[model samples]
Target: MNYPFCIRCGWVLALTFASCYPGLAQTPTPARDTSFTVYSALAKARKTDPSITLARPAVPTIIRSRMNVPYCTASGRALQLDVFYPKARRQGGYPAVLLIHGGGWRSGDRSQHVPMAQQLAARGFVAVTAEYRLSTEAPYPAAVQDLKAAVRWMRANARTYRINPKQIATWGFSAGGQLAALVGTTNEETRFDSLACNIGYSSQVQAIVDVDGILAFIHPESGEGDDRKSTSAATYWFGSPKTERPDLWRQASALTYVGPHTPPTLFLNSSVDRMHAGRDDMMRQLSQFNIYHEVHTFPDAPHPFPLFNPWFSPTLDYTVAFLNKVFSRK
Candidate 1:
C-alpha cells in the first residue's frame, strides 16, 4: 500500500532550539554509516527475553498543514512542497524538516506524509513534505537532485517562512526514506549537488529520519534487482540493474557514502522488512564512525505501518523524540 492510511481525514496534530547556536555559511559535509538489521536486533533481544512487550501507542498531535507551496523549478517543472508549521513558536524561528514520501521511486506523492508532517509541526518543528521527480519522469540522480534543489529553496526562503535554515533536517518514508538518507549522507558532494536553482545556498541538514527506506539497492535484500531484464523499482531508479551498471547502484547507495561526519540519524523500521537493504551495513558504518544514531522496530508491522493507527501514534512519538534530541544538541 503506497498510499498512506487516513485514519481521520478530519483529525489533527514543540520544542525550541532557536537562538542557541549559529548555523553554517556553506553546507558542511558530515561524516556518517550503518549497523545491525532490525531483524538481527530483534533476534538478539529476544535471545535475552523470549517475550518483549510492544511499544505503547503515542497520542496524536495536530497542526496547520499548508499545501501546494512552490519550492523550486526543476528541469522546466515547478516542484511544490507542503509545509506543516507549528501554530506557535517557542521564541525565534522554528527548526525545519524536509519531509519526503515513498513509493519505490516510481509511484507516490507528497500528500502521503501530510499527517506525519502536521504532527511534527504541532511538536514545534516546521516540517515540509517535498515533491520530487519520480522514475516515471526522471531516474537515478534526478529525484535526488530535485530534493537537493528543494532543500536549497527552503533554506533561501527560511526567513519568509519563519524557519531556521540552520536547523533543517531531511526526513523521508520508504522510498522517500532512501532519498532522505541520500540527501543527508551525500551532503555537499558535487556529484549529488543540483544546478537547478538556489545553488548558492547549502542543502546540508543536521539530522536524518528514515522510515523503512531501502538504503542500498546493491544489497541482496532487495531480491532479484541484479537482473537487467527485471522490472523492479531499483532498475527504474538506476536505469539498469547492478549487473549492467554497478557504478550507478554503488553511487546511489546511501550506505556507500556514510562517513565520519554524517549527521545524527534515527530509523523506524518493521521487524520483517527486507526492503530495508543495507541497514545492517549502514548501522555498522555509523557505529564505526561513532555517530549518534537509533533504530526502533515494530513487531510484525507492515512497511506502511507508520502511516496507520495503533502504530501511527507510536511512530510519531519515536519521531518527535529523535528530532528533539538531535535538534536540541548544543
Candidate 2:
C-alpha cells in the first residue's frame, strides 16, 4: 500500500490558496515539477533489477507512422496524436488501439508509448499515441475528454488511416490506464464528450487494457488522497483532498460506471497490490453481465514493467492476444 508521492506539499498549498481566492483562480497555475519520464522510470527499475533497460522507439519499414497529427482543439490548445499503421492494408480496415502513457496525470507524453505503437502497427493493427492536457494544464475530466476526442478522431478519419471504426480499443499504462477505463466504460455518456472535434463521431472503444492503474480513487485499497503525509497525484488532479471533495473522487472512478454496457477489459498488473484497487469489484460486475475480462500479474515486477524488457514482451503479447480475441483479428 506504499506508493511514491509525486506532488510536493507547497504545490498543494498554492492550489488551496487559488481555490479560496476567486480573483487568484483566474491567474494561471504554475506547473509542478514532474520528472516522471521513460528514462526516469527505467532508472528506478534498474535499481531493483540491473537487467532491466529502457525500451527505445523505432519505426519499422513495414510500419508507417504520422507524427504530431492534430486530433482536437481543447482549452484553447490543439491536442495532437501520433499514428502508426501497417503498410499493407486489409480488405476493409484493421483493428486500432489507442496507446495512452502514464505519469500520474501530470508528466509523461505521447512519445512515451511510441515503441509500443510501432510494434502494434507491425503486428497488423493501427496504433495511435495521443497527448492530453495534464493536471498542470487542466484537471480531471479534461484528460478524459481529450482521450475520447482522440477516439472520435480515429473514427472520423477511418478511411485515411485504414482503421476499422468498430474495432477501436484503448490501451493505457498507470494513470492513462485509469483514463482508458473511464472512457471505455462511459461510452455515449454526453458528459465526457467534447464538441471540439469530430462532433458527430462516436468516442466509444470496444475493449480496454489497464496496466497497473487504480480503478477507484477512494476505494479501500486506494492510496490516493493521503495528504496527511504528502500530496498525492490524485489530490492534485482533483484540486482537493479526498476528505474535502469525496464527490469528485468517487465521480472520477471508472468503477462508478462499470455496468452491462462496459466493454471487455484486460488487466496487466505488477505485483503491487494497491495498484489493483477496485479491480476485484469490477471483475465481479463484469461476471454478472457475462462480459469477458482477463488478468495477468507479473511476480515482483515494478509498476512500470511495460517500459522494460523482461515484462514488455509479455505485455505486448498479452495485449495483442486480448485485442485479437475481442476484435476477431488474426
Candidate 3:
C-alpha cells in the first residue's frame, strides 16, 4: 500500500538553478543501441544485490514552473523551483536539500536531478531542484544571483516547508558544483541580495556535495590539456578563458574560499574527467581550515560516472551517511 504525504505550503521560494515547472518522475525510455540506458544502472545494481528494492513512493505532489516570488535576478527573470516531499511524513520541521544540475550552465534540466532528490526525500529530507539562467540568456553573476536567491527563498519559507532552515544542505555537479561552492563560501556578501534582508536568510550552506568539480587553478591532467573544447565549462563559468581570467577563476574557485567558518563538504571525482583537477589542492585547503569533508574518487571511471554509473553505489550511500552526520550535528 502506498502511503500518502502532505504538500508543503505557505513558503515563498525561488529557483536558483532549477525549473519553473513542477517536478516530474520519469522512467527512461528504451531506445536501442544507445550508448546508455536510464535503467542500465538500476538493473546492474540489482543484479549484483538481489536484495535491493527499487520501488519508490510516488511524489505526493510535484510542483512545476512556479515563479519564485520577489524574483532576485537583475534581469527580473521569473525564476522557478521544484519541491519533492513525502505526504505522510510531517513531524515538525525536516532537513532540506537543494540540488543544482550541471550542463556547463548552458544546457541541463531540473528533472534530470529528480531521482537524486527523490532519494533524499525517501531518506527523510525535503528535496528541491532548481533552474538557473544559462549563458545564452545571461552571463556570469546572473546565474550566481539566481542561486543565492533560491537559498534565500528556502530560508524565507522555512516555516511553511517545515524545514529547520539551519539544516539545509546543497549538492551540485560540474558547473553547478562551482555554484554550490560559491553559495557555500559566500554567505555574508549579498552579490544578489536585492531581496529584503529583514527576513534573516543567509545564502550559506551547512554542508555541500561537489561532484566532479574543479577546486583549483591546478587540474588533474585531464582538464588541463586542451584549451578550447576541454576546459569550455570553466571558461564559460569564469566569463573568460582560464589564462585571461586567472584572478576571476580563482575568486570563483572553492579552494580560495576556505576558512574556519566554511561549511563541511563532500567531494566526488573521477580519474578520467579533465575537470578533476585540484582535488588534492582542495583536500589541502580543507585540512588547513580543519574543516570536515569526505572525498571519493573512481579511478577508472569517466567524468560524471557517479551520476551515471551504478557500480559505485558507495557514492550515494556515503552521501546519505555524510548528510546524516553533518545535519544532525548540534
lDDT of each: 0.71, 0.84, 0.61
Winner on lDDT between 1 and 2 is 2
lDDT of 3 by residue, 175-285 (tens): 677677777876655655554432477776798888776666444443521353333544434445656546766666667767777888988776644564666776787
Off by over 4 Å in 2: 1-17, 20-33
User: What is candidate 2's lDDT per residue for 92-122, written digit by digit as tens?
Assistant: 8999999999998878888888889999998
Q: What C-alpha RMSD separates each model from the true structure?
A: 13.4, 3.3, 10.9
Off-target runs (Cα >4 Å) in candidate 1 are 1-62, 224-230
Residues 1-330, model 1: lDDT tens digits? 122111111111000101111110112122111121224334555555556433333424445666788877765768898877766655568888888887767566776667777777777888888888765555578889889888888888887667888788898888888889999998958776755588889988889988888788777786526433435666545555567678888888889889998988898897656757888889999999899999999887666666654577788888888878887883
Best by TM-score: 2
lDDT of 3: 0.61
Clashing pairs in 2: none
Reference-based TM-score, model 1:
0.79
TM-score of 2: 0.92
Candidate 3 minimal-lDDT segment of 10 residues: 1-10
